[model samples]
Target: MLSTEADSHANQSDDYAVAPARAWFAFVMIFLLMLSDYIDRQIVVSLFPHLKEEWGLSDKQLGALVSVISVVVAVGSLPVAMMADRFGRVKSIVVMASVWSMATIACVFARNYSQLFAARAVVGLGETGYGAAGSALVNGLFPKRWHSTLLGAFFAASAQGAVLGVILGGVIADHWGWRAAFGAVGFPGLMMALLFMLVPDYKNVVVRFAPKVQSKSPKAFVKRLYAALTHGPTLLWVCLAGAFELILVSTIWAWMPSFFNRFHGMDVTDAAKHAALVVLCCAVGALFWGWVADRLSQRSPRNKLLAMCVLTLLTFAVFTYAFTAHLEVSTQYALILLGSFLMTCSVGVTTSTVLNVTHPGLRATGSAVLALFQNLFGLAVGPLFGGIISDAWGLDVALAAIPSIAILSAICFWKASRSYEADMALVAAVLRQEAAGERVENTAVLPPLTAAQA
Candidate 1:
């Protein structure tokens, strides 16, 4: 049992009951920061041509520039998230945004490839816990009813930001230089970080899972974290299912432009735009499924698992045929668009599910754990595996083969469905106990930590 909301919000008051306007402001700022985070991360993709021309780099080296960020972010997320949980998300975000933004701006002065690569790694480090912390912030601020929908919108920002990054990077580079692209995207993030300071901080929830005497101890904290993360079947399966879903998403998004160029005879630019359109469709699907999931789960929390299961099945069916049926180019692209939408059904669902069962005090850390799985197992594996398959059997075969992963993801959701209700109920009880305990303490002679009071 670990959760505490605002003083104004009673134990059962939807956290939004107090200062709803402030919650909206916080969400808006966090949304901008999320957009800026991905934009900085992805803007480099569009600069590949510029880098290759200026430095005479190979494709492999150019690719590493992007891959390194994912690796660093995957590795760094947990520790940063732990610190965020202990401190405050707003302050941590301010520091992270400043570091990453300055690092991105620093790329403009890079002397060579190594310098640029190092700067990108710093960007990853800064971004490590942002998603986790942001998700926690928004989820805690809103009530359970809005969790799926708002989280859906929050997650959609990543796809939207990536699209903006590519388009803005290319456009800015064409007008100015590749260096200017980094500066353009990075500066706005720094300014947004400054504005974020105005958002109020949620009252820090101490770890109720630990004994009060040992609550702040590092060893106790780690043990409690491990227990929370590994305690239930829901978190484990949902994480794996989400990772598998991303394999489908990342494979298509990374290689589809080349797939079209190679198989359908579309030019590079048109093919890229074509892929972007599919991702935009995914963005839409995330919101739609979020709504659907909320409606289905009104009776029981576990119904959300069924939504993800159906979504993955739909993705598998659509992608398998689109890639293998030998259809017309237009027909295939249409199916790919549908597949894209279907694959994103778990975006908000996965994170919201994680938060639902997690101790509210550990919400941000729980999100980081999910982020770790997604970045390391899902995002990292998808594009690389697709490339490996492309090298052997060709792009069409690779894309067609990847849909089989959706079957595995669907299986995971069904397995998760078994225990989700139990796990969610368990955590809700814990939250209620902790919330009531706080009320008792506050009523009983609580005192401030000050020399004068002592």
Candidate 2:
């Protein structure tokens, strides 16, 4: 019996080998999971017209609903990261999907803006956990060589989901009403969580179904979290870059539809159609950038994120012009596509850079921290801030502010590359010492090294 059980386990391990087929399957799953988040986010914006009409919401009130959701997602990111590190990625996904599924379903009950806002906030909590855990899982599953490519594929799915959510929600709202649209998209997400159960877990180069036990306690988790934040310039810079990127991305997602609807005097369907084109362009851009990053990484890892900085600056200009320009429908379509492609292209680069420098065991924690900062500044500040600006200065002037933010993000990302190179050396050295069975002290601090370190 014991021998037969051992043979069964051996066969299972053998099946876990990195076949191309399996890798592609894992990529598909990651893409699907990412799509879920995009649907959740995009659905709200698509339904905004119906909801505004039904509830008679002011711009300020609607802004509050979006802001509250961002705040919860930002706050939830850190704790979720810690949970991911202490537990496992799969478990985190399970809990997050369940929580968000319920929160989304609860949206059906909310007749007022405040009630709906509260439900959205709860949804944010689940989304945060899912984002951190899912990203880490993708990193762990794929080889280092293709990390950017795989993650880029995942990011591209976000654009696809956005397109689907906007088109589907808008069509449904036109026909059925807003509540059914929410339940229709939100309920399927719960099933995706269940599907996650079939996926294997990756830990220390082994794939297993059972949760791997962690030696670290909650106290240690906190300690490590502090150490990571306070002791690492690379991590700080990367997180800052993420925050900046999110700001631009979030602003675009939250308000671009409104921008089109109001500025072009188009109905929800027409606005969504344009937005769908933008989303498709973004998806294409994401995949292209991922391919570029993976190719460039063979020469220098820094190229991964450096490319992002350059593209972001370009995107800032394109987006600003797209929103501010008073052009014909054809011209408008061209500008939106150009802007989206440039903006989303950077996703693969930025995500790969973060994952590459992060400590192996703390991938999820680090991702969480990045997500938190990004959400706080990007999601929280960008959309609401943009709305306020639109309210005060008009949409054109307010949107001009997006390029400035994007430029700032570009600068931060560029600066982060230098610090990241240095940190990679330090981490590599620490790992080397550990391999030698040396109990190296001062894990938090390392003196400066020559260019060789970089």
Candidate 3:
């Protein structure tokens, strides 16, 4: 019996050790796709001044253009994620990338406000499921212990994409034209979609979620989703925390270029350059914090949750000072960079938390739920609310006030910390049962366990 157990452990270890080269290559390809995804989504923001001048648009209208995508993405995420779960993740990703790429190309032909808005909505439709499905796919490719660090790096691609979008969009718009920026950024995703087909699927890759459910029915999917959302007290609070964080993040991403252009008297290109630097700082922060969370989580899951709560408060304080203080331009920029970095620290941690408590069958759906809250409350409302406030008072006042939502976020994350360990243990119990060759339903409910018991 001892030899048998040792052999089992050795085989598992060998499996993990054999697949580094192919696994990392697939990871890089998927990471690049995510990078392209954000570039297409964010490129429009860099053209805000040009769009406002040419279209005679109001701040509300410009903000609406950004918010509408989030609204669509929020509305579409669940259904599309379900489709990915029912269908194949690789196939769904290819199709999604293709659709969004085409929609972005359609932006080049948009002659007026309505046409552009419609195109952007379609872009959102194509993008709605990509994040959830992509993350789920990444989870299947990497070891469980690496989820936070790798997903953090994966998600950090958004910041890099944003940086590229703002900087390259501004430069391209200046040199070629705003329409050219759309075409230039949009075409790469299509080629990447083709390249993605060559990467191995979950079966070939050998890194798969243990004890996965094989259900595919819509009813089963819905039930699994419901189970995932209600699996523990922590999921809802974590989702809410993420939503609030995105509220601050979306506002910054949507408005910072304009903030610099207006307040610092920089040209559009120069303003985007500065904003890009701040976003790069955010990317670095996401990776740093994710790595920190992974290391701390090695000691206890509560440590990562506590870290998120603390970072939220820190983010709020720094951002408030950046916006409200009458500091010098350089000083304010420094503060904004600091605040942006702190604000993103929770990205990977929250994602890993959700996945930790969720069943493998529902990970994509779980991710979609988080995205739904984030988009509906954070992405959809944050920018539009800021726009309204800016119209009422000024842009600076709007930024300062909007980020105070982080206080609520900190509260939610803190509350979640209380229940996280127990919930994780519950998930582990279910996975263990399934690994023991017992048939497990998606909606199987396990009795609660206390933290001490866990």
Candidate 4:
């Protein structure tokens, strides 16, 4: 099946000239750094109890540690992605990894809650535009057909790192201390940062500017951003769908340990490990469904959004029932695992959807806009609100409420499906413009493509 699918994209052209061996090697390098990225980001979740116990902190404060990173990533990603153009993606990523890794290590020396929170924010700052830079580099290096699958692979790395972080944080904290857990995960990212420099960088896109445009002007940049942000109905709808789905996914990732510990009567380490195991299922599901969505899209491009919508509905059904029914603990865990799997159905495909409709020069910025929505509205909201609601009412209410967004997510994807073909036409015309040696400058803000031109 995989071989057959590989044959489908055999005609897709790669923009970069990386050797096959070198390309795969570069993927391995980037994949590891992405893994390291989440491990550092999520390791603190398993230490929430420790922080709460030691500092006598509120749940909101503990949740703030996780939410702050997403908030920072949301606000900083646009500017940070711009840096990838200036510094080069490979070099920028190396610097990003180094900063985040060092910040993670600095957590070990934090004496108060303020100090620790400051370090986590630094970690967020370092991670700001990594997805945008990394995705753009990977997209250019691989065939067009491979873009969505590779993106799925990238996000699978995120789930993989998260699982490891949650498990390691609990185990190390139990045996050594919470601080040691930080050191253990922190040091490896530094090593990975140095190694990431060995990966090849993609060639930059150089285009003649339109007479009215200034390449280096802040006004030019904002226009470019505005174009990407409001490119078409498909990109807008797809971005919203991905953001809504993350409400459930991030809430689960952030609160899984506490949920297991409280409801299942498990110890902190045991609960973290259990939650990590559930998240490992999430990684598997993301990769598997991503492959399925890709194959479905081969028959019809619109099938991708349809696939996402179906999976999201499945998530809502499973989660709503599991939380509301008086089921056994084992049964509940089983349902939650399935829910986790289905919740991220849109993750990779949505980014790919944005890429398909966006100008190649603005692909990184395009993905960052999705990141902006996902972080600010989805990831940032999930943990903070979960903690607040849990404090105000109960954890179960927060958990159950999060999955309802899946309904809205499905609706958005369905709406996006209607506009997919029209949006792809515009992108196709833009690609033709590039091929014809005509600069399609700021096409995002320009008039729609006619059927004849497309």
Candidate 5:
């Protein structure tokens, strides 16, 4: 018996030894995909001024482009998410990446605002699949213990992508025109997508709460989607949080270049440079939040989410003051940088929180629900609302919405925090019951996926 136990331990060690390399490879691939997604999204923002000038478009028209994409993304995320669960994550990622990249490249050939708008919508549809599929793949690739931390790294890549788009897009647009900028950013993602096919699915080794569960048929898929949308606090809270946050984030990213150029007396390229730096700071904040949350989870599972609530509350003040203040250009820049960084910390916090609370089998579905809220509320409304406010009430008034949204988000997260401890207790009880060979009802209330014996 002792010899058998020693052999089991040796085999477990051998299995675990391959995890680090797998985790790194998965992290790099997901990071690049996320980076590409953000870069694609940011291209519109960076080129807005040129597009507005060349096409003689109004703020409302630009707003429509933003709105249409978000709406499409929201609508597309669900079916794509279901498809991911039903079909295959690797296939979903490849297809989604190809579609979005090709669609974005099409933007270079668009002759009218309508054409561009349609292309952007297609890009959104592609993104819905990309996000859900990539996230599910990431969860499967990492050791269960490292999901949040690796996810944080993945989130950081997105921020880096945004920053690169702002900085590099500006330079590219200035040197070769906005169309070239789009073409350059869009084409590279296709290569990344192709490379992704080389990575095999690691879902087999990664423990899941529903390990033997098979994908639902289309009818069951639709039913599950509906159930997620209609019957749970999970969807509601995620949507609210995503909406408010996206609105603030998108609004700022989409229009900040124009705002800086107009208000600070800077050029487009210069504004882009500044925006890049600010976004880099946000990336740092996001990464830090993830690390902190993961460490905190060791002591209390709720610590991850609780940290987010605290950041949101604090950042609200920072954003309010930054937007409302009248200071020197340098001072204003510093304030904006600091405020945006603090606010972005919530990205990692919210993502990990949502993932942690959701059932393993429902990861793709949960991600879809989040995509809907994020796109509709955050992406669609945030930028368009900011633009409208800027047109009618001035940029200052428009940006004020960010702080208000942040405050509301803080409140919601705080309420969610109250339930975290109880949720943890329930999960622990379920895990214990399962260990004792008793049946557990709700799959969501189980121990962390990694802790389960396969």
Candidate 6:
């Protein structure tokens, strides 16, 4: 009987393999849902000029519309992700997608700034849980070797969605009206949410190798949450690095259309088209850099962190040149494209780092914690602060200054590299023990690394 049970365990471990078609299908569905999430969240940015002109709003007010969503998403991600961990990820994602889609459609009916603001907040509420849960689900479907590549590709959906949102919002708003843009992008998410219900989850496919201990008590839940949050010192530095990098990312996504319109004298649609191209570059960069990081990590894990740090520094330099150099319009666009591409290289790598250092059960919550810090410190503040600075000086000055945050981000990533190997080994040890049917107590705490290890 013991031999049979052991054989079953080994077979279950092998059952991690899924049909390529099914895996890709699930990937596409989740990717589309994520794409829709960003489309709903970011469509407002493309409407900034329209809203500003119609309402006679200031840049700060326009920026606040974007910031409000990030603020709410930052606050809501933790609880919503916990729900995903406890309940079902797929069901949670469907509900989330529906809520955001409905909220986005509600934007079409909003009559005043207050109404629109509330609608945007609801959109945030729906989106806060999706990324973390979606990433966790995708991770479970594939082997760890593919984590960075797949997650990088998965996260690239954000840039792709943002590109579509800005472009479609601009084109539709130009032809039909800004309100029509909202309804156009919002409805597809509802359908996508329903379609997502058909995809299978990891629990259904993979039989449990280790005993499943679903934490029923609040105390056990708290302990798990705490462990997830403090899994390693590397988590803190990675989150901080990602947060700092996002300041630049958020600023660009939020204001690139305005920047083109103001500086290049392009129309709304034209500006959006150009910005969409830049965002496409960002998507490509995420995949390219993620692949590069994974390859480098195969050589040595420390190389992954080094790659992020180097990419960030390069991004900063290119962006500084793009904004500060008094160059031709074509040259500026080329530089912006290069800068945008480099800026996203860290996204997949950082996400993979967080997942690798934490326990499997805490994957969604771990992602949520990363999102919480990234949104709160980066997304919430970047655009608003940039807008305020733009109002005081000029948008050009704001763009120039924002890239400097990459310097800090690079430093944090470099620091993280120093501790990453030790933390990774610790996580591996714990996972191995768990695989052998040992319960790991205080799994979050690792023994201090000796000088030799360092």
Query: What TM-score fits each model?
Result: 0.86, 0.86, 0.89, 0.91, 0.85, 0.89
Instruction: Give lDDT per model, in order.
Output: 0.76, 0.69, 0.81, 0.81, 0.69, 0.82
What lDDT, from 0 to 1, does candidate 3 have?
0.81
Candidate 4 residue lDDT tens string, 1-454: 0000011112136543477889889999988998999999999999988888999988788889999999999999877876675557888899999999999999999999999999999999999999888887777678877888888888889999999999999999999999999999999999999988889876554322234443445665555455533447788788789888888888899998988888888889999999998889889888888788889998999999998888999999999999999999989989988888877667789888887776665666677888888898888888888899889988899888878989999999999999897888876776666556564432322332223322
lDDT of 1 by residue, 1-454 (tens): 3332222232124557338899899999988898898889877766665677899875456556766776787788887887887778888999998988999999999999999999988998888899998888887677667888989988888777777776676678778988998999888999998888997767654553423332445665555555654346788888898888887776665566556656777654555567667768877888889888988888887888987888799889999999889788789888988888888899999998887767665778788888888888777676667767766677678888988999999999998999888887776665565557843443211112223212
Q: Supply candidate 2's per-residue lDDT for 368.
A: 73
* Predictions: Cα RMSD each: 5.9, 7.1, 6.4, 5.7, 7.3, 5.9
Which ten residues in a row are the worst by lDDT in model 1? 444-453
lDDT of 3 by residue, 316-355 (tens): 9999998888899889989999998999998888888887
Task: Give the lowest summed-lDDT range of ten residues in model 5.
Answer: 1-10
* Candidate with the larger lDDT of 1 and 5: 1
Which of 3 and 5 is ahead in TM-score? 3
Model 3 misses residue 181 by how many Å?
0.9
Extract clashing residue pairs from model 6.
Answer: none
* Model 2: per-residue Cα lDDT over 1-454, one tens digit each: 0000001111112233245576567667667877877787677777767777888876656666667767887888877766665666777787787777778889888878778888988888788766666777677666566667767887788788888888887888778888887888888888887787766556432111112224335554454344433345766677777678777776776676777888778898888777777778878988998898778767877776688788888888887776677778778668777877877766666666665565554566667777778778777887688778877887667666776677887888788877776777765665556446553331222122223322
Clashes in predicted model 5: 3
Using lDDT as the yardstick, the better of models 1 and 6 is: 6
User: What is the overall TM-score of model 2 with all chains considered together?
Assistant: 0.86
**Which run of 10 residues does model 6 get worst, by summed lDDT?**
1-10
Q: Work out candidate 4's RMSD over C-alphas.
A: 5.7
Per-residue lDDT, model 5, residue 311, is 78
Q: Which of 3 and 5 is the better model by lDDT?
A: 3
lDDT of 4 at 157: 91
Model 1, stretches more than 4 Å misplaced?
1-18, 48-63, 175-177, 208-223, 229-231, 260-269, 391-394, 435-454
| Candidate 5 segments exceeding 4 Å error | 1-18, 204-235, 424-454
